[model samples]
Target: MNKSEMIDAIAARTDLSKVASAKALDAVIETIVESVAQGEAVTLVGFGSFKASERAAREGKNPKTGAKILIPQTIVPKFAAGATFKARVAGKDE
Candidate 1:
């Protein structure tokens, strides 16, 4: 679901107002982003982990012209779901 819908869900579950929920959600997202951008891993038990990963430079072809190009290396955010999150997605009755 989208951010508003997620805020609604959080409000319903926690008795928080929509505004408070939004602030909380935003805070969480900002924290995670800042941490990952600083090359730190953030993990929540039974949920997932987020971190920055390095991507090596590689050669690629332009789709339209098929011209060879060098793709520069970079660091990108990555996520890995924890076992419990994976299990729930897979419909395990745990």
Candidate 2:
């Protein structure tokens, strides 16, 4: 679901107002972003881990022109679902 819908759901579950839920979500997102930017991982026991991965420079072909190109290496954010999260998505509880 989208942010607003998520806020609604959280409000329904937690007795929080939409505004408060929005702030809560925003704070969580900000914290994650900040931690990742600083090269740290964020792990929620039953959810997942958020971390960064490095990509090596590689040669690639241009789809349209079929020309060779050098793709620059970069660091990218990644998420690996934990056991509980995987179970929940698979319709099982861990």
Candidate 3:
């Protein structure tokens, strides 16, 4: 769901006003983004972990031109779901 829809759901579930729920969601998103940008991992039990992974430079094929291209190495954000989160998504547990 989109941010506004998520805010509404959170507000109703927590008995919080929409404004407060929005603020809380914003803070959570901002905190996660900032932490990941700093090359740090953030983990919430029963949820998941966010971290950065390295991509080594490699050769790639340019599909459009059928040519060789050099793919620059970089750090990319990655997420790994916790056991509980994975189970919930797989319909094994909640």
TM-score per model over all chains? 0.97, 0.94, 0.93
TM-score of 1: 0.97
Tens-digit lDDT track of model 2 for 37-68? 88999999989999988999999999999999
Tens-digit lDDT string for candidate 1 (1-94): 9999999999999988999999999999999999999999999998999999999999999999999999999999999999999999999946
Candidates' C-alpha lDDT: 0.96, 0.94, 0.95
Q: For model 2, what is the C-alpha lDDT against the true structure?
A: 0.94
Q: After superposition on all CA atoms, what RMSD does each candidate show versus the true structure? A: 0.7, 1.1, 1.1
The Cα error of candidate 1 at residue 54, in Å, is: 0.2
Q: Would you list the rank order by lDDT, best first?
A: 1, 3, 2
Best by lDDT: 1
Q: In angstroms, how far off is 24's CA in candidate 2?
A: 0.3
Cα lDDT over the full model 3: 0.95
Q: Mind sharing the TM-score for model 3?
A: 0.93
Better of 2 and 3 by lDDT: 3
Ranking by TM-score: 1, 2, 3
Assess candidate 2 and give its TM-score to the true structure.
0.94
